[model samples]
Target chain A: MPKLDFDTINLGHGSGGKLTNQLLDSGVFSVLKNDLLDQRHDGAILELSGKTAFTTDSFVISPVFFPGGDIGELAVNGTVNDLAMCGAIPRYLSLAFILEEGLPMTEFWDILVSIRNACAAAGVSVVTGDTKVVERGKGDKVFVNTTGVGTVHPKAEIDIRRIMPGDKIIVSGQLAAHGMAIMSVREGLEFESQIVSDTQPLNHLVKDLLDEFGNNIKLLRDPTRGGVGTALNEMARDRDLGVHLEQRALPIDPQVAGACELLGLDPLYVANEGLFLAVVSGAAAGAMVGAMQRTDTGRHARIIGEFTDQHPKKVVMTSGIGGQRIVNMLIGEQLPRIC
Target chain B: MPKLDFDTINLGHGSGGKLTNQLLDSGVFSVLKNDLLDQRHDGAILELSGKTAFTTDSFVISPVFFPGGDIGELAVNGTVNDLAMCGAIPRYLSLAFILEEGLPMTEFWDILVSIRNACAAAGVSVVTGDTKVVERGKGDKVFVNTTGVGTVHPKAEIDIRRIMPGDKIIVSGQLAAHGMAIMSVREGLEFESQIVSDTQPLNHLVKDLLDEFGNNIKLLRDPTRGGVGTALNEMARDRDLGVHLEQRALPIDPQVAGACELLGLDPLYVANEGLFLAVVSGAAAGAMVGAMQRTDTGRHARIIGEFTDQHPKKVVMTSGIGGQRIVNMLIGEQLPRIC
Candidate 1:
């Protein structure tokens, strides 16, 4: 194949089809050959002598700093939570920043401090980093990408494939707090109560649940950009199973619910930062819920739904008025930069 | 010390001073609690069980695709060269992208194809990756971060710390090609000869040199962001040595030199994507230069300078007119996003 010219980038580059494959073939894969990248999986799977888990996330939030959290905190916790959701003990992280020229150094300092505090609170360490500044106006204020490496217990076998019919789904805390916080701040929405983003790292909370419930936990996910609805839909699709959610059983703060209602948004589609949905065996669901309730971060834990065999690849939500509606994948972009 | 707040960032963060220290202490270091990061050195000192080298780079170049290369190729080659600089055999890479929403899918796909091709040429692999989208206007078209791992031969012990007073500086190929290409396109500078970027992976060239010189190579740097002059200045400062360069000995493509002169830019400060600066003991410099010349990428390699014990942390240049002047560190930001 001919090598890609460096003249310009066309939209076909990102299509995930022939052109995408060509770009990868002509430009990237040609330079750094390796086995793991050849697999082309969603993530890399490694065999390790010691217990370890690795994950990464990138923060491109607009305005750099926003209500509740900024890129710094988001970058840190995002990776930490990815490890936590996997039943891994979060440990260290690699932080890399792409800064735009003319970005105020003071602002970068503020974000760095936030990152330090977040790490301290989460009990993880920042081990490595790379920083680069792009031309002015060519980049946003800053973009943060973080990669985390953690240790997982040897016996843990958590996987989405373990989810079965009748398994109960429990949410860790209030939904839509994060998305509402960002929306309210960005749009200057006035409300009786200010909605703070629930962007806390949940490694400890995850540890607590795993310590009590052991292997009963089938799967875990942090409903972020696409929100809880999208996360559930993905789970259903991945397992070839149906999920039935009860609107009345879902937990939502009044401030977040009111904000979503006012904006004509569904709480189900609003992103959550410090919340997670877990699938546990039917017999262990009650015990898991009880364990979750004992932790402050999981005080709002509730049995929102259950996995089912009917209507695989679909999420059906029983509305407050007793009508069932299919919760399909997100049709379009909703709240932006809620991460 | 007071904790750093996330509400806003300030300029002092990158100053390498009190605020910078606080930012690391309160934000970054607090979250990533690792021994390597705690050291706060120019680069982390990692110990591997086997012969291995690890390096990472983030490409935020504007115009996603530029005159000679794009983010995809740059990410692959940048990391590959970093590992090679450490005398490691280039192998694998992890590619992660932070994409702006509404970026044409076509462009994204093209970049992937470029990545695939670049890896094939470099004999590396894209073992793992992550994809994220931010709201329109929140991010640039795309940002790519690549982390690479390679294995070093057991006998190699390349280190900048080994640089001595009687060391010779050799530059591979022409200087300022990459930077000139970017500037010309960005500024619409018309020239009789259109200068294309010199972006290419150099691990193979590096292999040629290492195979010939063995452990005689003292230091290697790609001369990226701040350019050849900046990279040399950094080495001088880091090694507590003095550098003297002969202007007449430097190899400059006439077109690139003309572009620099026309724009009132210094060719020495312009970035080069496919060139590297190596400092070797005077005794081994001749053999090393011969090895470099054997490779197509290093055909124009030239001996440009030498290191000395006097005038530590200073770089002096013998001008073409026989006048001597100090080459100081870059005082302020030069052309942004030239990478």
Candidate 2:
């Protein structure tokens, strides 16, 4: 990290004056240096063609720093994952920050480094961005917003319309790890082991899947703030189809499950960051799962459910105790700033 | 405007759950209805080709509502202007919001309407976005981030390398109107007439200029946060060139000038919302000024200065009273959250 002369950021750092330039020069620009961003122009110019995917997300994750990742990593991975879910190759990102005055410069530098590292991990560039500061009491520590653009895969045909009743639903990996991690910190709860946020960029794995499956990969979504239950419920409602799940097949870390159980929260309604749900053709399901298991991030991938014509527009889960129940959309916030 | 069931937004609205969907259905989606955003997908897919400009900005302007504009409009126009300055025809925008819990629904709705109106005026679409609500005191009322993408104008060649010593510098309309307007509200000062913010979209006027002047327009920039003084100083430093200005030629609304004088602020150091400084080829400067004067937003446009090699990397202005002084970049916070 570049040594900053100031101990903390003040309103002057956002004044778009001498202080602002100093902040950018020794801080942001020095770390995230690239030809495009280094130009210091109003925006970055890129050569693009074909179908492009555009998306934006603001990260206000509380605690800023969690076990496995910080808000910087989540900000990059979240937007990159969104483009990946659209079957796009994550290319470039625009990162804007809203910093509260009086935030320690050390904390800000750490976040900038994390952003640079995350961008490298995702193989994307921070092309253009803005910085604004509010009075100390007017804002929390910091908030980051990332907007991403990527080109769609040539062979990918990811759409809800492609999902049929016979399509198989697959979970990429363990669930409830991200939400449980934040909850654990917020509630000061502990288990036998530490629960870490599963915040990782899924672009590489998504590209691999799209290259192999092409049109067979019907839809892809990461269970974020609303979790897997909300994602699945929305899919069912939109497609006018039902989803059938086997509780035994839902892969989750034992610690995360325990934490959720202890808190009376269902694992299915808990958020997952690095994980994703893929809807695939029934014939390709088995092969897809096998392929996913060979990848590092998807070692725990499994087929947890299937789309059905029965009980249209609903999600039915068969529990380990042999009882079935309907899974509805989450009505209220389970945890604020869960990311 | 669509009537909402809730009087104020809560954490649930940002939960990505039932309440979140309801908020979107009744608020965002309803006001900014478009086919791309209505898909409710992870991102919007656009068929874009050739050279594109990308930029992002976060607006944390206090007093969400101001004379002649609001934060929403500023959010949209700010990004749109950034793209315009890059010599691109603004195309699509990604809107993201960080709202505080307990914010009145009416305020949020009015902002949404302003955003919609601004988008229409700029001829851009809000394709994808995200909203995250923080705890009541974790954030101020609201913060907005807009990321915009636009196709570069084929005829334009905007670059500092293209600027020469004899290039003419032009200012579009009055200076310090925006900063003074916000200050008037904050200081509770009354002017002979209302000091309204000169906040409006400049993409149309920019398009017209690019279409006509092409490469003759060496560079374009909006004198926003740091005002014209800071922008020119940066330009001079970047190109290792000097800028010579005639104060008699600087345009300013009389009331705005008086307000700045009373506040002990220099008009050159104040912010502007709907003004720009263009560096054009001296041979085409006269024609460009004539053309700009015919446009609605540029009626007061005039040649204010010229690039020179006399004092390299310096900006010197000659006053109407015949005294000369150096103009430097703004050093400290003039007005925080002035947008």
Candidate 3:
């Protein structure tokens, strides 16, 4: 790192001048150094073959720093997971930051470190990036937009359209941790246990599951902004299929459930950063669960439900008491700017 | 398009609820509709081969709508130019939007229309996108981040490192139009002719120069945020070479020059959305200029400078008065949030 310090970012840092270079060199480039970025060109040039997955997401998560992770790691892992959801072996990412003036340099530096570590954890490189500054109050502290590109592994043929009736729907680990975690901090609720954001890089866990299941894994989606219910509901309507979810089998962290109850929110509608739902063939569902359970991030993997032909284009939830009800996707945002 | 209508975007539009689907299905989904995005999946899947270019840029240009263009086209073209600078045949783009809760639906629709036309004009597909909403005052109307991927042509060997002594520097057209245009609107200053933004897509113009010159074309850059001077200064420093620019040879529209004179700004340092610089071998300088001049976006193209070994990594300007001076990269923003 260069031996220059500014308490916070000034307009000059985004001026594309000496200060911009100074800031990038000292804070970002020093930590995320790589060959493609070192080229310092407008874009990164790479060699590739076969199918590629492309995705983009901007993290404007309020309270830039949250329990278990900050916006930095979330930005990196979010895009990486989007690509991974498509069975793409996450390889490269492009980061863009729109920072508010007067943001503490120390805060920015911490984010840079998180991004660097997250990229390493995800086995990807941030090959290109851009930064812009907005006047104070016009922007949140820092909003990150990350676009990722990755090559799809040949053995993986994942697609929602490929999902058929009788396919088992398995959710990786617990649900609602990420959303409830944000709610906890935002509402200043002190529980026996602080709810931690489930923000993590899921590429390794995905790789392991894909390796064992191969083409048997029909679909994968990280239940993020709209949570598992919203993601599954959309899939149901998009593919014109019925999904039957069992409440007893659904894995939820007791702490997250308690927090949601206090907030009068449904855990099914809360978001998750590290967890994903997988639709696997019945023949391979047991093996898929086993593979996920072997990984640290997925040790709580369970078969939550399956696709059914009874109610086409709808999702039905079975209660523990044998009662049934329609599980509606969220109608409006219960929590705004929650990532 | 769906028949539902609303005057402005409400929190529901971003709620991932019925409103979110309605807005997307009617407005965005109707205009930039394509297969990869229509899949309703988390990410787009594409097939690729050979060398590819990956780049990203976030547009926070204030006064979303301006003289020559709006933030919509700028978002598309800015990304397209980044890829074009890499000697890549621009193909696909992913657009992400962060809209404020109270933005007018009509205004958003107009920008959506502009984005569609720019994409068609540039011959690139909008394959995937994401939308998020912040509270009314938390965001400035809308901020867009576009990430693009393209296939590199076989013959082009564009690189700043390829630049060497005796190379000729050619600019695509008149400078300072973009920055000046933004300043005029923001400061509420009006010129006799109303200096419009030179915000056109330059992919075809770049392709023409590359097709004719091939590897003879050593380097390419778009003078967007920091203008021609900053772009050249960066190239000079990056390659450790001297760039000698001719003041009289520089192309500046009469109206743009007049506006600059009134504002006490140097045309050299103002931004240009549609302009680019080409460093070609001395032997092919004339041919390259001639090629650029014949194109619509490059009709005013001219030779602005040349590289020399005398002062490595410095840019010197030779005025018509036969005086010499250093042209520095902008130290601070001349105009902020001007794209």
Candidate 4:
């Protein structure tokens, strides 16, 4: 066997192939030496003395910072909501920062403040962090990778596997608000009404759902960069289920709808910051909708869809005029740096 | 009260003045929210249920990476030894990465691998991490900030304040080897002999010391960025004591001396990655020196200096001809990035 070179790394290292694994095994795993890392699973199976939920996310947003949140807060809240979606109480966060030098101290400070504020609002402590600053012109502003650990409630058993064909999908708020907000700022597009980024911390609203529907809440996900449509598509594929969303039933602010139309973007595919998609048993769907509407962040909550075993691994939408279409994962970057 | 501008950070933020305190309270402390951070002390006071040791350091090395270790591994081991200096069993680490993006993944991976390997060699786990990637053209390669935690045996208590005037100061292995290696690589200076980085994990040798002399050891420190001279100065300043070094007693590798002479750099201010200064009580100094010499990493361990109450806060070095001179901290970046 040839001796591995330790001088430089190439793009092939991130290709998830033999070299990637070799890099992880020889370089990363060798140093990280932990049982959890050794598992090499899609997600780590952490054993907790108390009930807990595990969540992981990869952040590759361009331009890192924008009007609302930068990659810092996005990395923090993105995983925080994943745990919250599982009805878990978020408590600890592990942060990883990849930086390119020549970046200004002012911009770094701004992002750091945002991350700190987000953790405080969510009542989670940033127990650990890693920073690596690289040479100039070699990286984008910054890329943050975060993993969250939260304690799950013993009685809360929300799972997508429980969704039946007649299950109802309640969107916690308006569609296209976050996506349009980013587009407006990035493209310098103006509207009759100024659009503000709908970025927010959602742990409080999650607690409300746990208090109301408990286990009947089958699933929850904050529709972010890929939008509500991609989120529904993931849920359908994960459980070998299908989803039918009603376009007319979806609530979209008139301004956001106009902005999407002007930009030739689909409201479903445009990102949302403060919105969550909830799948509930048909019996508890109405009560869940009622509970969500009571919160200020969820006043626009609506029953936008239903699950079906008929069209497996698909998300079909019933248009306002009765037309039908399939919703899929984003092919490339859309409205880059909306986070 | 005036509304603060959110544009850029000024030097005052790091000055440890009013602005620095405000930045800490409003930005950093607000996000961290921990008791240890709230104490507002030069060093955090951690209450150990069992036995433990405390260590603190401020890292501001330029270029961050050179021939030997980068800021990442340097940050890890620097504090790791601070604990080892106290006979503490290092077990956990907390890392903070301040990044300026546009940094190549290649450099990031190299440093990351170094950090991973260093932690493994030290028998420590990085339990928590924080990362912030700044904008392009704003930061140098990268700067890593690290804090470490370790456990000590119940019977161990190594105190620098207990050092008597006649105590022996031992230099572990060769002086200025790491610094010279960095300069050779950075300046592209080649010699008949290759000057390999003297960066080696020293926890194992520390273990040997504990096994041999235990609490009789007064203090230990890896002469890193500022070399042995600055480390001794800091000890003198902190303990309000004088340190006297005999020129003939100091150990310097022939190659290191040649490299320093070629580069016009002082060996006293040059960095040492694998060397440490140990202040020991007279009774056990001989046994400790014997134990250090027996180890592979410390074969050249020799008595270099003594402590005294005279000439307070001064580091006096006696010349080979019996003359003396003062050694002080390097005023600015020397052999930049020679970590």
- Among these predictions, the greatest DockQ belongs to 2
State the interface C-alpha RMSD of candidate 4.
17.2
**Two-chain DockQ for model 1:** 0.08
DockQ head-to-head 2 vs 4, winner:
2
State the C-alpha lDDT per candidate: 0.72, 0.92, 0.87, 0.65
Query: Which fraction of the native contacts appears in each prediction?
Result: 0.12, 0.89, 0.74, 0.00
Candidate 1 lDDT over A1-339, as tens digits, reads 134453223323322222333344453332223343321211222222354455556677766777788888888888888788767877666667776655654576578778877988898766445666655555677788877656674445577889999999999999989888888888899898788889999989888777778788888788876678878887887799999999999999887888899999888877777889889999999988888898899999999999999999899999999999999755445755455
DockQ of each: 0.08, 0.91, 0.77, 0.02
Higher-DockQ candidate among 1 and 3? 3
Model 4: CA > 4 A from native: A1-66, A69-120, A124-182, A204-253, A266-292, A297-318, A321-324, A335-339, B1-182, B199-252, B267-293, B297-325, B335-339
Off by over 4 Å in 3: none
Rank all candidate structures by their lDDT, best first, as comma-separated numbers: 2, 3, 1, 4
Candidate 1 residues lying further than 4 Å off, grouped into runs, are A1-53, A100-102, A134-137, A208-215, A320-322, B1-56, B86-92, B98-102, B127-140, B149-158, B207-215, B319-323
Ranking by TM-score: 2, 3, 1, 4
Report the C-alpha lDDT of model 2 over A188-304, residue by residue, as the tens digit.
987778899999999999999999989999999999988999999999999999999999999988888888889999888888899999999999999999999999999999999
Determine which window of 10 residues in candidate 3 chain A has minimal summed lDDT. A21-30
- Please say which candidate is ahead in TM-score: 1 or 3: 3
Judge the docking of candidate 2 as incorrect, acceptable, medium or high. high
